[model samples]
Target chain A: MSGRSHAASRLVVAAPYLWLLLFFLAPFAIVLRMALSDADTALPPYAPHFEGFATLREFLGKLDLENFRLLADDALYWDSYLQSLRLAGLTTLIALAIGYPLAYAMAAAPRHWRPVLLVLVVLPFWTSFLIRVYAWIGILRPDGLLDIVLGGLGLTDEPLRLLNTEAAVLIGMVYSYLPFMVLPLYAMLEKLDRSLLEAAADLGATPVTAFLTVTLPLSLPGILAGAALVFIPSVGEFVIPDLLGGPDTVMIGKVLWNEFFSNRDWPLASAVAIVLLVVLVLPLALLQRARQGREAQP
Target chain B: MRKASPGSLRRAFQPWNDPAAKPLIEFRHVTKRFGGVTAVAEVSLSLYPREFFALLGPSGCGKTTLMRMLAGFETPDAGQILLGGTDITEMPPHLRPVNMMFQSYALFPHLSVADNIAYGLKRERLPRAEIAQRVAEMLALVKLDGLGKRRPDQLSGGQRQRVALARALAKRPKLLLLDEPMAALDRKLREATQFELMDLQSELGTTFMVVTHDQDEAMTMADRMAVMDHGRLVQIGPPDVIYEAPVNAYVASFVGDINVLEGHVVAVEGDLVRVETGITGMVELDEEAPALAIGASVLVGLRPEKLDLSHDEPPQPFNKVAGEIWDIGYLGDVTMVQVMVGGEGGWLVKVALTNRRRRAARPFAWEDKVWLSWDVEAGLVLKP
Candidate 1:
């Protein structure tokens, strides 16, 4: 019985690992191989397709870092990377600024009303994401709903030119990723021991001081998790920027798309994708390591 | 175990007896209600400086509510709370010069022990060297000297309790309120911590008001205690007085184990009263009798430890009854035997006998016919 149960547990553990190997690792290996090869005019658009094990050594020898080197040498790729990082960082900060108070209010609401608030946070997910992004266009375009409302309210004399701007892109991203930020924060703040706040007050810290010293520090794990959820996705976001941002708003995702489809530079696009993964994964891995080290302390 | 004799210390510092002594904290006609239920209703109390006071009651007895009002967590609806002659009824909790050791300890999980202790001091914006010195002193005071760098989760429960105590005390408030301070500790640790807390309170000379449900804990640590029931202060006195002379039936049973016998006053002789009980026949109490006509209904309260049990008939004639042993409970320190007197459908009276000798043979068994007796001073004549 024990041996059978052990085998069953092992199978349960292996399922996710197996899934990752087949779906993620296999595709990543193919991309890495394509990234190392040379661009060509052939149907596949990349040279040195795997010919068999007999020429394996030759295939390995043909692989090079030329695409990566070209990416580093060009200013457009560098600028796109920096702009992507900047936008993603700004999105995270704005989302946090909006999400923290929203989550805190929900957590402090009456117990029976909490479920309704949580449902409201997650309600937007029921709608199609693409449809929501399209809806933003109608609201943000000049002479659209926003401008009409502002003009009708006597707040503005002329139509607002907000569509296809970086501001529109920011508004779209913050609206889409808000739930991702709020849920974790709400979960953290809701379960916080209220006695700790009382203890703080008992110890002579005002409510604001208590929030800064006790609540904020304790909610850090939730903050980090929420930031990662918003940052990692917004860094490579293709839809919001493509739909709402102006031509001057150059992000790496748009650049990667242009390189792969318009220019048909398969190796360069693969290299760009690889470099983006490394940039995002490195910090995340470092953060996980630091968290684990702190948890392991006596 | 060296017992800290708070009894002697309390006798030497009985400020409540002195008419001229001013109370450090006072609550006057404080009334708090939640929705339809009155959690604390028209309650008034006082605590003198350096007095280790306890509010003892069962859950929902308003003991915690009273403490919370003093700690500035709850505002009284219609009353005044004065601290050192200043009315602080509407003062915010942070502005109040009172701190609380929470029932859950409420230690900050993210902070090191030293930082947790220094939190209130930092709020005062003390000098850096003074903060460190005070933190070190608190650490030593709680006997957590070398564990200052450890996080709260890393410490044991007892250690966490000490950290809470230290953190609350670091502010040196005029009054430190403890809400079931030792409720989280194990029984063994709880007993030891009670004495330690008493010692610490005396050494620091800070007035402490603890709220708890455990009678033993309150009796062991409190210089004086108040028993609360259903949002009202039922009785207030030292532990001995509360135990020996409870004003009513609820206070008597709530404080300790007492076998109540239904009886009536048969005669009143100057300072002595003779009562006739169904269970123990005629009993005489050698105490000042309350105003009573002959045959007025009364309750005779007999503490278990005050009664003696034996196989043979007791030498005394009055206040003795013959009964069959209904049950025997052998606790390590004492043997509690329930004697069913007055034959069938009669009252079962508990008699506690201390085991002074190791491995003493069982003197009483179940179904054994035994005689129970007590001195005249042992029976309390309580009005029914």
Candidate 2:
């Protein structure tokens, strides 16, 4: 019985690891192999395909650094990388600015009302993500709902030129990723012991002072988690910018998509994806390390 | 209002007795209501300087609400609260000269022990050097000197409790509120921390107001305690007086284990009253009941330990009841014998006998008939 139970437990532990290995790790290894190969006009779009052990050795031997060098030589790749980082950072900040207050309100609401608020937050997610992004197009386009409303209210004399702009992309991203930020933040803020605030006030700290010293510092973990949830996905976002943004909004994800489908440079696209992964992984690994260090201390 | 009470003479720190001694904190006709429930209703009380006062009650008895009002966490719907004779009714919590050691400790998880203690001092915007100095002093005071650099998670429950105490006290507020200070500690540690808290309170001379439901803790540490029930103060006195001379049946029953026998007053002569009970027959009680008339219904309250249990019958008639032993509970230090007397609906009196000897002189067994008796002074005549 013990042996059977031990095997069952081991299987439960191995399930997620096995799934990641089969799907994520295997795909990444294929991408790495494709990134090292030279571009071709043939089917599969890359040279020296792996057929067997000997052919694999030959493919590995013939791998070139030309694709990576080409990426470095092109200024567009660098600009796209920088733009992606900047936009992702801005989206994270915007989400945090809006989500913190919303989460705080939800947490502070009466206990019975919290579930309704949480449902409202997650209600938008029931619809398809693509459909939501598409809905933003109609709302943000020139002479769209915003323009009509503003004109009807006499707030604007002329039609607002809001369509296909960086602002539109930002609106879409923040809207799409808000629940990601709010859920984690709400979870943290809700679990916070209210007596701590009372203790702070009793210690002669004003409300604002208490928030700065106690609430903000204690909610750091939630803030970091929320930021990561928005930041990581926004960095690699393709659908929102593709639908809402103009030509000037050249994000790395857009660049990768164009390279694979329009430019047909499969090796170059793989190289860009590898570099993007490295860029995103570095900060995330650092965050995990810092969290571990904090846990280790106490 | 001051009275020359005899219990005040036993304590040197009886500021309430001195007519000139002003109270450090006062609640005048304070009333707070939560929705349909009145948590605290028109409560007026005073706490003298350097006194360790405890608000003792069961859960939802408004003891906590009273303490919260004093801490400025809850505003009273009516009446006023005064600190050092100044009206602070409208003042916010941060402006109040008070600090509270939370029941959960509420130690800032991100801060080290020293930093947690320095939190209030920093709010005062004291010099950097002065803040450090005070932090060190507080750490030393709580005997957490070297552990200042360690975060709250690194400390044990007892240690965390001390850190909370040190942090609350570091600001040197005139009044400190401790909400069930020892509720989180284990049985052995709780007793030790109680004495430690008492010593610390005396050493600093800071007036501390503690809220607790534990009768033993309140009795052990408080200079004086107020018993509360249904959002009203039932009795206010020293532990000795509250235990021995509780004003009503609620205060008497709530404080300790007491055997209340239903009876009616048969005769009354000055301080002496004779009560006729079904189980114990006619029992003489010494109680000052001026309004009690002949044939007035009353309850005769007797502590379990006060009853003397014996196998042999007495020479003369007394306040005694003979019954067959129904149950025996050996609690190492004492043996609790529950005796069932009379027929149906009989009185089941619990008689606690100390196991002081190595061998029992007369060991009691189940179903054995035993006589339980007490002196006339031991029985308290309480108004039913």
TM-score of each model, paired residue for residue? 0.97, 0.96
- Cα error of candidate 2 at position B341, Å: 1.9
* Per-chain TM-score (chain B), model 2: 0.95
Best candidate (score: lDDT):
1
Which residue pairs does candidate 1 place in steric collision?
Answer: none
TM-score (C-alpha) between model 2 and the true structure: 0.96
Each candidate's clash count:
0, 0
* Model 1 C-alpha lDDT per residue in residues B1-384, reported as the tens digit of each score: 776565335456678889999999989999999989999989998899999999999999999989898888899989999999999999999998899999999999999999999999999999999999999999999999999999998899999999999999998988999999988899999988988898888888899999999999999988899999999999999999999998888889999999998888899989778899866789988867768789988988999999988789988869899999998898989989988888887878899999999977888889999999888899887755
Residue-level error in angstroms, candidate 2, position B194: 1.3
Q: Which candidate has the top score in DockQ?
A: 1
When just chain B is superposed on the true chain B, each candidate scores a TM-score of 0.96, 0.95
lDDT for every model? Answer: 0.92, 0.90
* First chain TM-score for all predictions: 0.98, 0.97
How well docked is model 1, in DockQ terms?
Answer: 0.81
lDDT of 2 by residue, B1-384 (tens): 333333333356777778898999989999999999999988999999989999999999999999888889999999999999999988999989899899999998888999999988988999999999999999888898899999898899999999999999999989999999999999999987887788788888899999999999999999999999999998898898999888878898999988988899899888889999877898988887767889888898998999988888765476887888999999999988899988546778988999989776648998898888888889987755
